[model samples]
Target: RDLCADFECEPAEFNGAANHVHLLVNLPPKVALSRLVNSLKRVSSRRMRTEFPEPARHYYRANTLWSDFSFAGSVGGTPISVLRQYIEQHNRPV
Candidate 1:
């Protein structure tokens, strides 16, 4: 939601395991990768702290939700069908 509103990026998929999450987003050509990442982390952290106080308190004592590092890559070279299939298959079972 925030991504769409702020960055004009559409989030296509989101999946997570115990400790981390994978997000697949379609960003406009004008958006910078570093700026997008920082915005996502900041907005998500703030929203999490406000919405889930108990978990946020336990996990983020310093009021920081995400780590300083993140991983991002380009999927433009690959076909969208292949990427979507890979993400779907890699998602942890509920």
Candidate 2:
């Protein structure tokens, strides 16, 4: 994705539902999470506006495509396999 290329990060995995997405990104230590997140939100918003202008314009007219708050957790201690499984599981039909 453009976000990864701009930030010099790699997307190890990606998944999503109707309202949200999960991205397992591998980025450099020098890149701050806040900055990356801001870029991600910006890029996503731009793409949404380009791809689906009507809804994005209506729903995000006042705010943004993403919430002001974001949930970010470090997985320094978690195994990649487990993380992959957990993320994959969330995408399954409930």
lDDT of 2 by residue, 1-94 (tens): 7668888988888777767778788888998988998888888888888999888877685667777878776679788988887678767311
Lowest summed lDDT window (length 10), candidate 2: 85-94
For each candidate in turn, the TM-score is 0.83, 0.83
Candidate 2 has a TM-score of 0.83
Segments in model 2 whose C-alpha atoms lie over 4 Å from true places: 92-94
Clashing pairs in 1: none
